[model samples]
Target chain A: MPFIKVRDDLCKGCKLCITFCPKQVIRMSDRLNPKGYYVAELFDKEGCTGCGICARMCPDVAISVYREDKKEVPA
Target chain B: MKVVYERPESLLDVPFTYCPGCTHGIIHRMVADTLDDLGIRERTIGVSPVGCSVFAYEFFNCDMVAAAHGRAPAVATGIKRVHPDKIVFTYQGDGDLAAIGTAEIIHAAARGENITVIFANNVIYGMTGGQMAPTTLIGQKTDTTPYGRSVEANGHPIRVCELLSSLDGVAYLERVSTHDPKHVLKAQKAIKKAFQYQVDGKGFTLIELLSTCPSNWGMNPLDSLKWLEESMLPYYKPGVYKDIG
Candidate 1:
């Protein structure tokens, strides 16, 4: 399964990722960062195909996407 | 796990100072990604302009130089001339490029300087509280043009890519926007191409990005993106205006 990690300290809560994500996997969380900005979180983990559009759209570079390595899987 | 997307190595770990939803961070990442993709991060020297991105020196992991307001092209020219083997690039905003540093950029392109310029045109001066820029469209309301820009008073908005297209020295010129993911991806490709041109010894490649200034534009991030698409796109068409390669 693919997943994204959001760096809470870096996110400005601009919601750009939320706006541009085709899967609508991200949303502005109620929790605020140290800067008082409500950071975005991955709300729909199953919907994320790990396309990385949110990471690309993120101005703060707060999101990092990771996917399972097929080559590392046991046969 | 395999890392699919993350911060480019050419960018430092420090946070950007741009306002929330400001596209400067996006543009910076694209440039950094290009530097990393070209494997020129070690040999790349970036010239920071005096605008909202004035602190760009601190963000890019490569060697950076701070130039006088609108004088980034001039400084980049000097660096490229001295260190021809090193890839030199200038990151500038509208007020810095189209307004005060017009002569520097024009002459640099006219002289066929081999340097990459990432010109971010947000239509308004973001650092200076939404002042009208040379690229500000007519009827656009800015701090300086509270009643909307008038052609008679503000003259006319400068079309930089079109203006520089006729220059014989220009190797590549493209105008792109970062309003949506699709456009942002295209803009990234344009940035990579401009840097590739520089690596190939092509002269004077510039990628003009239509950026958004949400704080200065007095709109939320989403609204500002819409405004950029609806208002700025027709005036500054997004396409390759010139390509010699």
Candidate 2:
């Protein structure tokens, strides 16, 4: 399944990623980073299609999306 | 796993200093991504302007020069002329570009300098606190215009793309927004094209990005995006104002 990684230290909790995620997979976590801002987390891993929209909308460049490559798998 | 989206190598690992929800980070990433995609990061020299993005030199991985207030275009011109092979670009905000540096930008475009300019228009002066800017909308309340900007007092918002388009030296000019993901993608495309034009030795290229200043605008990050779409979009219609190739 495709998934995303959020850099907690870099996330400013602006929620742009949460707002733009078409799948509603991201949410603001109760925990705050060292900077005292809430960081975004992937709540529904299965719902994400790894479209990378969150990464694109992220102003902090804190999100990165990854997906399994089918082409590299054995036929 | 294959990486679908990650930070571009052209950007430094440091977190941006922009306030929470500010769109400068997004525009910075797009420019860095363009540098990475064009494989010109090593040969690229960026001119950092005054305002909120003054520290842009520290964020971008390539060589950077901090220009005097509103002198980014002039600085970029000198750099491009000295190193014709190097891809030179200037990152400037509205206050720096449309206000103090108006003469520099206009003359650079008029001269058809082989350089790229990334103009960020947030309607208000971001760094020095929210004040009336050259691009400030009519009836928009800012620190200077508490009651809202008035045509009789502030005149009208300057449309940089429209003004620069008429110059024969311009090779490409486009105005884009960053209110949504779709528009952000379009902005990236426009940025990449502008850089491509520079690489091809085309005359001056500029891409105007409609950006947001959440802190100065006194709105949450999400609300600022909404404000940009609702208030800014109608006045600054996003589209290609000029393109030579």
Candidate 3:
């Protein structure tokens, strides 16, 4: 039940993360960001294992992943 | 929800301005993560060098200072000597380090200055429009070397790790590449070790990072990475050149 989020503004559409995702859960979007780069988007959330490889591979640090078992306490 | 992976706290919240597919951002994040993990973010000080990483002062969360071209080692040495307790590092590129700053870095290392250095070798000078650097290999075409690097005109590429391996003042010197994920992981580990050496008051630790300049190399990001694996690794083999206690 891991999840991934892409900060659209931060992503420069290099798509380096898409290639690094072991589960092939990410893909380039048809839409473009303000910076004119085609940002990455999730193709299949169910296929994600929350490996965080995309996060590590991202040059912009735009990807964040949260594992299913970990719950955050209320701030 | 628990965040499994996010930007390191040691880096600013602003976006990096490096060119698309530039590996500088990744290296910055790895250094920031290492500092945060070591609990030395507040005590760390970095010297921003000339070249592509000149704007490093803005990206790193800790205190930072800018230095003249190839003068980062001198500036970092001054900072560390004035504040011995603070962790000091200089971020430099091939043109800045192996070329112009050669004298400064060699003297600093020979003196056994307790500081860490992050050396990025992208083969060509990225910021100045892809000129030939000291680390540019033969047969490589750059802005200056349009036809190709001619051995008769240009000397062979300088291997930084091998050059500094014999220095008694150097506590650690390792070369790592970022062309692939496995190598990137290893580079991060080497970066961590290089910084930790400084934390332990070890002298003159440097990690030469082999990186890509897709825009300058005249290839797409993917192809540039492939070219690096095929062409660069043979000359600048990655491994621990020296890791003396």
Candidate 4:
């Protein structure tokens, strides 16, 4: 389950999160947001360890992370 | 939900290189916990000084920059100015801030730089062996001061907060200690206020933390903390020296 969502509007295109993601899941996209900042895109949600490092280093409150109950079955 | 104390996500999983019972970890925790509560962990830029706490760059999971000896304030100033919206702060130990970096911090506050400073005062230089520092109390004995610090020879310990608080540009100043649980809690409150003051667009903020360096002090952790209370606290009482917030 993808828990970390990057708010395009607030992203400053710093790419710090991309550099710090231990899972190598976040990357800068070619598509620029309205603010002209490159939005970070997540390639794999399942690989996320819920470390929240990306959320902690975003420089902007652009990322939100949540953990899904592992016991829950898919609908 | 059960609550438990743990390292913040903004901190790395790597073990700290600091010595056992060093108060740097406690100061690190205070800053990280503040970031967690303010939900600004992602946006914080931590600047590391050149002394013992220099490796703080590795411990913090957030964006961190290692500044030259006693020059964290200068580096932090640049970062904050370039990224005005980002939460910028510098963590410096006694020698780094109160000694060589003294001019940098004074001018930064004089310029009213919108940044936060976390100053750890352990009285002695921990990394380069226990040398006397500007914050070392008079009559304190160290490797450099084998016969005890003489006021005539070294002068008195600098009162950093008092000096900074008198500056017109300063918006927040607090002196706290990490020696005990009670003081630790109070220090956290002051640390939170320092960060919050920065976020609120207030002027320069500095949190002077009276810390203990057991290894450098040539004493056990418990005795060092006790020395901090009995010897250091009287000279540097914990309180908000100035608060515009």
Candidate 5:
């Protein structure tokens, strides 16, 4: 599974990620956090490619991207 | 398989928009490569200025802000103040820094803003159609200086690193160029040192990059690089003006 995390407090709400993501998995969350800036959220993880576009586009260094890889064991 | 020199992991795979043979691309690559090497990409916030590199906000692949005109230093100050723990730097061009934003840079250094400034001094206003800039050589001609810059009228080019090193607030200052591969590597080292100073909680740091504007200079890319080596480097030699470390 691939997941994206946004440090809500650090987000400046530049909206650059929305424009750069190829999967369009990211969108401005409807709810405004305490900072009054719209936080970025992943609308669908199934479409995420773990390309790390959202993390790259963030101007505040507020996001982190992670992907889980499973190693198969010989039966 | 042969090894390839790939783009830095800190930089996106997107192609740059700079003109062919423009040194901004080289400097940008150096900065990105340095960030990747230092493992600071995740904590970096780059402030892009208004000049040929104005769209640097797109190229860095890190958190970046667009500063008005030459006010990158001012914007960077705010970002650094709010997030003192985060690494902050500014990418600026000659017209953006030395011409319109000179006062801002000077004050930022004087105040010891604890940020890195990557100043690309191409000696002409590139984005605005190649106007004579503060760093333009004494006899260099541009759109604004049709008959070449007269020393009596335009004055001599400002030695920014030399001037900034004289200040007590600045912890590091270096002038470098990207007209050649060897010098490109040297400039990269200087840029890395500037960022390292800020990360170490040292005061202000600035790296003046002597870049080439081939399209604006009306010369082919190779010729422009040659001119930069034979003419520009002679006037603006590369060196570390100040390094506390």
Candidate 6:
């Protein structure tokens, strides 16, 4: 399943990523990070298409999306 | 697993000082990515204005200069002239470009200076509190215009792209928004094109991004994005105002 990974320490919990996700896969966690804002977490990995909306919309660059079917662009 | 997206390397590691959901952060990343993609990060010098974008120097991972209140165009012109080989751009807000720096921008485009301008038009001034800017739509209420802006009393919103499009010296002019993901992608392309024009020796490229000021708009992030689509889009129609390229 495609998934979303958020760096808890870097998240400001702005919810922008959650707001822009068309798949509605992300939710604000009740738990607060060191920054004291609620961090976002993926609600369901199975629903993700890895369109990269959440990852690109993230202001803090805290989220990264991975899709198993796709190949990495070699650096 | 394939990594779909990550932070652009041209952006610094410092956390953004932008307010939650502010589109400035998104615009910043796009410019940084464009510079990195074009291998111009080392040669780019970004000038930031005095509004909300004042702290932009801290965000972009390039050599940054802070211009006086609404003088980024003048500053950028000087930089580009002195270091002709360096890529020069300016990050400016609506208030900075449309209001106070109107002369600077007009003359810069008039003279066909080889520089890129990333305009973030959020309608209200973000840094010094929310006051109605020159681009604020009619009937829009702000800190200064408590009831609403009356066209008769305040005049109409200045569409910067449309105004500058008439100038013969402008090489490329576009207006895009950050209202949604698809539009964000388009905005990135517009920003990239604006920068690419300068690299190709095209003159005075400007990409005006219709951004959202949620805190001042008194709306949540989601609602602000919706407002940008419903309200701001009608007044400032998104399109290529001019493309001499």
Best by DockQ: 2
lDDT of 5 by residue, B12-75 (tens): 7555666645667667877897899889999999999988888888878899999899899999
Task: Give the number of the best model, judged by lDDT.
Answer: 2
Segments of candidate 3 deviating more than 4 angstroms: A70-75
Assess the local accuracy of residue A68 in candidate 3 as a C-alpha lDDT between 0 and 100.
50
lDDT of 1 at A57: 88
Per-residue alpha-carbon lDDT of candidate 2 for residues A8-62, written as tens digits (9 for 90 to 100): 9999999999988888999999989999998999999888888888999899999
Q: What lDDT score belongs to each candidate, Candidate 1 first?
A: 0.92, 0.95, 0.90, 0.82, 0.79, 0.89
What TM-score does candidate 2 reach? 0.98
In the range B1-245, model 2's lDDT, one tens digit per residue, is: 87878999999999999999999999999999999999999999999999999999999999999999999999999999999999999999999999999999999999999999999999999999999999999999999999999999989899999999889999999999999988999999999999999999988999999999999899999999999999999999999999988
Cα deviation of B133, candidate 6, in Å = 0.6
Predicted complexes: DockQ each? 0.77, 0.83, 0.65, 0.02, 0.02, 0.63
Rank ordering of all candidates by TM-score, starting from the highest: 2, 1, 3, 6, 4, 5
Model 5 chain B, poorest ten-residue lDDT window?
A: B1-10
Off by over 4 Å in 1: A69-75
Model 6 earns a TM-score of: 0.95
Local accuracy of candidate 3 as per-residue lDDT tens digits, B65-121:
999999999999999999999999999999999999999999889988999999999
TM-score of chain A of each: 0.88, 0.90, 0.86, 0.82, 0.81, 0.87
Show pairs that collide, candidate 5: A59-B63
Per-model TM-score versus the true fold: 0.97, 0.98, 0.97, 0.76, 0.75, 0.95
lDDT tens string, model 1, B32-81? 98888889999999999998999999999999999999899999999999
Candidate 6: Cα lDDT at B200:
94
| Model 4 / residue A33 / CA error / Å | 50
